[model samples]
Target: MDDARPPRARHRPGAERWFRPPDEERRGPAGTRPPWLSTLLVTAVVLIGSGFAGRNQPQRVPLDHVGYALLCAGGVLLLFRHRFPRTVTCGTAAMTAGYLAAGYPYGPVFAITALGVFAGIVGGHRRVAWAALGGLWLSHLVLAHWLYAWLPPAHDHAAPWGQELIVTAWAVAVVAVSELVRVRREQLAKVRAERAAAARRRADEERLRIARELHDVLAHSISVINVQAGVGLALLDDDPEQARTALTTIKAASKEALGEVRHVLDTLRAPGDAPRSPAPGLDRLPELTEQAKGAGLAVDVTTEGGHTALPPGTDLAAFRIVQEALTNIVRHSGSRTARVLLRYGPRSLEIGVDDDGPATTGQGEPAGGGNGLVGMRERAAALGGTVEAGPRADGGFRVRARIPLAAPPGRATGTDTVTPDATEEES
Candidate 1:
């Protein structure tokens, strides 16, 4: 079947430029028209007032067909004041001037015009609103003079200057009210944006902290498991007793790791609940050395100077730093013997971990790719502390950290003092 219509042409690039949909069209679906309906209601009120004023006048100006038409036209223009505020303001002002000049009775037309001007200013057409107000004021002055000079004075008693003053005051009030509303809306929007940004930042920080906690718990436990597994495998046939001991070490390490991981998870799941176990601190150094010995590493602990109690956060950070350092020594440094030194000063605590082992690589990275050193630095820096880690001149790795002893704000220093037991070797 042959059709009379021509074949459709293919669309070219930028073809939509000529037929782009308007913003209103893209939004789709019209909502309720309550605002426009309210404007129509206001216009009706003005029309009724005008009619009533014209009928009740003792010396009526006798509005003819044209005068009545102008009065109605001015009120009608106000129906669209919100949608086209500037245009409605000008149109209503012109119609009101015509009605007044035609010797029509003064009515509610001026009220409608004021509403239009207010809408224009609130709609962000301030210049147009000001211009309309000035034009209306000037028109009122000229019209008042013409009425007094040409027509016999009726019941009008107000002076022209006084009338103009009242109208000017009304216009100024409208402008001030609109500007206050605009500023208040802007301030509310700014506050909402700032609150949202703060929430996002806090969320990011919490996620990072959780990631660091998981890494610290898992890395140390997994390294011990790896070493014990190797020992168990090597002695499985030749020495069952030693293999069993190695397996026991592995079991204990895995159990402790599981407990720590569960604790972290519980804290995340029920943040309002009290923690099931207290966080490990420097007091648990002996237990940590025992675990390291089980992983086939020898550790020596030494202490010097006064041991003052630390803030909870600082204490936790110090313990994590040492744990991460030792985990690195076990997994990366091929050292059998490691040394830990703790020094307490008047205003700071110094911690040192040195191992007589070959560096994993020339760049001083641990065996497995990890962020242990970066985590150490972050922990120290959070408490106004510093850390240094690198290869030593004696062909081994050394990690040194200095944490300030300043108490946290609003907290008193603990009265309890910890005295470190001199050199203790674990193998």
Candidate 2:
């Protein structure tokens, strides 16, 4: 004989979904546990306390089978308080009223009712909790009046009005505590969200800064290599000596670029390695101009107003702006001559780069659509400075930057000091 039973429901990958409450009734908030565990704990305590108190009642009224059954059912219903808080609260309240009306002994059954009310309020059901509380109050009033009429005259220990006042005060206290907890949880959640957003913003800024640094380094070096390679190819058949010289320039430029790129990459690697090379600054501008000259641009450098100290960050930004301007001149400007002017004022440093090349649509426009200018502006703005780039009326392009000398508040004035180089790169 084949035994037959309904086929067991298939347990799929997300089988737990079958047991989970609806999304709306799941929990108090995101990242919190479902309230089932807490509800079960509360039910256990109330059930045990009711049993103990029922045994200790002084003026015990006989509890019939129906009364005992109602008490047990009320305790079990508390297990679903979080999922159906209002319904559970009202059900417990009605059961308590029925037990008292049937002349069962007073016990901790009211404690279970109070737990339901608290659960309802904390589970975000304020209106329903209030309604349940009202219904409970009315039921108590009727129960109290009925007992007064039915009990022996000498056995009435307290006035029904005074007992009602005590119960009302207890309900108010539960509501107040639940409201406080809810407000605190909400505040903590808001703070976490703000912290996450701030972290993301900082991460984005750091990424942009890294991208700008990589672009400036690679673009300048690659443009020099490109020009030198073309020169080598052009002179290969006509002037072998000049062609060899161009190849040498390409080799040196590639080596320096690779070193700088390696230094930057090492910073992202694990610590405990050799100390990093010093970052390039104003002192490196002469070498920069020489490299530009090797790539076939006639470069001139001039200084006025005397040199002054600068913060490391400001020094780095200034060097990068000039480097980017010269790179643009070599790659875009048709003219072969470029001039760099450095003016040190009492409160600021002015850097200007101008190339004698006609302004054209794509000429002097940084590759990838003006990201170079955007990076330059971001760097200057971070140091409370400004940069201007445009075509001169006479037909060439000029880029000027003004950086404040005064250090920003709370900024350290230590190892980042800028000093003028005693020797310049030979033309």
- RMSD to the true structure for each prediction, in A, is 14.1, 11.9
- Candidate 1's displacement at residue 313, Å, is 1.4
The C-alpha lDDT values of all candidates are 0.71, 0.71
Candidate 2 lDDT for residue 7: 26
- TM-score of candidate 1 relative to the true fold: 0.70
Worst 10 residues of 1 by lDDT: 418-427
**Per-residue accuracy of model 1 over 333-408 as CA lDDT, tens digit each:** 7888899999989988899999987865443543334578777776676566778887778778899999878854
Q: What's each prediction's TM-score?
A: 0.70, 0.77
Model 2: lDDT to the true structure? 0.71
Off by over 4 Å in 2: 1-37, 60-123, 145-159, 270-275, 364-368, 407-427
Q: Note the residue pairs that clash in candidate 2.
A: none
Clashes (N, CA, C under 3 Å) per candidate: 0, 0
